[model samples]
Target chain A: MGLIQRVIEAAGIATIGISIVREYAEQVQPPRTVFLKWPFGHPVGEPHNRAQQRAVVEESLRLLYEIDTPGTIVDLPFAWRRHDYSAWDQPAS
Target chain B: MGISRWKNQLLALLATRFPALAKKFTDSYTPRASTGDIPWVRPAVPLHRAKLALVTTAGIHHPEQQPFDMQDANGDPSYRAVDGDRLFDNFTITHDYYNHSDAGKDPNIIFPLDRLKELVAEGKLGSLAATHYSFMGHIDGQHIDTLIRKTAVEIAEKLRQDQVDIVLLTPG
Candidate 1:
């Protein structure tokens, strides 16, 4: 996934990836990423959890604009199935 | 299903249930290391004004499309062009490297197209690209080169042609 991100970014389009494995992101070094210590299949969040999914997408998109350094992986604070996503306010720009 | 597919499915299930086992599995496969400068592109527009697209390595495709090649141990590096507007009408997942039962129920967890649409409606996002891309995330060995040189580049060109300003990638 990080590999594809690199190719796309190299083509001049901004990219942000949601990575479940930090090690792979560290190795492939995609331009921007947000890491979640979640399970292998769930990158955004749990199934049917709209708020959680929205939070992940919002934070990731926000970082795409804010991250100036290449290969920066922001460790997301949301815990798998535990974080209170309903309270997640969209981060200030 | 072939024995390799069955084995991979079992491993995926086990890994999803056990984080320690998941770590071991990820540790077993080393992605190609970064050798040179990493690629970088700053966003050209704000969230509410940029055109967004999704690219996922989650093995999702239209049911009529060819399923990913699961018989190969190295994994398939090809991609599926997903129609963002009609994907939820019917879809299929062909990845054995991860248990996708939950994703099968609500693919928004991996693809999140529905959530993105909601964002567009609420004016938090600008719009979505008509076409998105999907690939199985288990590519390894020689297929990695094919992905980096061929398939990924093709998708990037397509995104460029579409005038996409930003992309959000997801994994499975």
Candidate 2:
């Protein structure tokens, strides 16, 4: 994604990334990146977690605004605690 | 268990069972971190309503592009392109590495184009470009980077030509 961002930026357009793996994405460092501590696949917080998801979207947008230089990453301190819910194991009704 | 903790336990077990594997994981582990700056000059005016596109690296191959090569299956670096149809139906991910607990969900489990389109309809995005893109992530580092860069360039060019504003990369 950072690589893509670089290419997009080099083409003279603003670019950013939403990295599932925050730490790894930071190393690649696109012009702008939103970091979610949530595990892979659930990048925008999680399903049914609309508030957190919106917050993530907002934070991601803010990254575009708050970035002073390229390759900026804003870490949103949201964690996915699937263990809190045992219903995950039950079959869907 | 937390994924991180599970990873630790898995690593420990691997070490206990296969010392060599443990050494390998320990040596190759790259901790994630936010570091470095990407050199970019924002558009003259930041894109207020940017169209978004998605790209995936899930080794999804269309029957036409190239059949999944079992010979190259084990350690093949090159990846095939999956036709953007119902190709994802009955999707079976084959990679010896990485945990497969998330497999068998929705093929979109890897590439969620429908979800993106949903957001587009809800006006979360200005527009969803007609075409979405994908690539197999398994490849030689040089080839992977080259192919990814080439694809990104093409996508960016086409999007720019089509007046696209943003691209959201979904790496599975």
Candidate 3:
């Protein structure tokens, strides 16, 4: 997270970040952030689940609304599925 | 700071110092390239609370372009080229491993444009960019360095053209 924040920061852009695990990001402090409870990969939602994806996007955007003060952080209301492997990792046959 | 923390730190030292094939191993953990500690090589557009864009690297294939070869994806798909200008109105999520793929490859996992539209309805954001971006997720940096940088430029240009204020990378 530090390296990415550095790269994005170096690009001269202010960034807002979201992460399932945000301890490292919190320590490093990107410009802004939103914390999510989902697993590492499905930050938005499950694969092929467009509706859930939209919800995630909406929540992430809301984070931008509060960025005016700078260094603002928000916690999202969404939760992650408990089951493992709702989809497959290997390419389909 | 704690006993467990110290133990974990010791383990990391031992692993790095006395791995079975220490010579064969390289310090693969690279930070994003930088001339120094300045961070990004180029500046991203200022993110205002306005219309935003989403980009994904889930190996999404447009109906018009060649489909992602599963066989190739399993191994040396690093040679594949990114077609940044291509428009993909229709796409499908391929593997479930997007949570673990590189940001450049499976961007959609992080930036879900389809979801952004819904948020607009819910008043979470102002709007979505007219067009989003996608690319192959499995390319090796060595093989696709030029393509990745070019695509970033192209994406930034597109976002600027679209008047997007923010880009949300979801990585799911």
lDDT (C-alpha) at residue B145 in model 3: 48
- On a 0 to 1 DockQ scale, where is model 1? 0.66
Candidate 1 C-alpha lDDT tens digits along B1-172: 7887899899999999998899888887788888899998788888999999999999999999999999888989999999999998999999998999999999999999988998888788999999999999878999999999999999999999999999999999
Clashing pairs in 1: none
Model 2's DockQ score: 0.31
Supply the TM-score for candidate 3.
Answer: 0.52
What lDDT score goes with residue B72 in model 3? Answer: 37
Best by TM-score: 1
Alpha-carbon local distance difference test for all models:
0.92, 0.51, 0.45
Q: Could you give candidate 2's per-residue lDDT for residues B6-95 as a string of tens digits?
A: 564365445434535634643453422234445676544343456655555444445455433323322233444343445555455543
lDDT of 2 by residue, A1-93 (tens): 455566676776665566755555655567777765444344544444444444555455456656786666777665555423332232212
Q: What is the TM-score of chain A alone in each candidate?
A: 0.91, 0.72, 0.67
Candidate 3 deviant stretches above 4 angstroms? A1-17, A20-37, A47-55, A67-93, B1-49, B67-90, B94-96, B99-111, B122-124, B138-140
- Shift of residue B136 alpha carbon in model 3, Å: 3.6
Worst 10 residues of 3 chain B by lDDT: B73-82
RMSD to true structure for each model, in Å? 2.2, 7.8, 11.7
lDDT of 3 by residue, B69-114 (tens): 4343221232112333343344343432232333234344455543
Q: Report the CA-based lDDT of candidate 3 relative to the real structure.
A: 0.45
CAPRI grade, predicted model 2 = acceptable
Best by lDDT: 1
lDDT for each residue of candidate 1 in A1-93, tens digit (9 for 90 to 100):
999999999999999999999999999999999999999889988898888988999899888999999999999999877788876545323
Model 2: lDDT of residue B1: 34
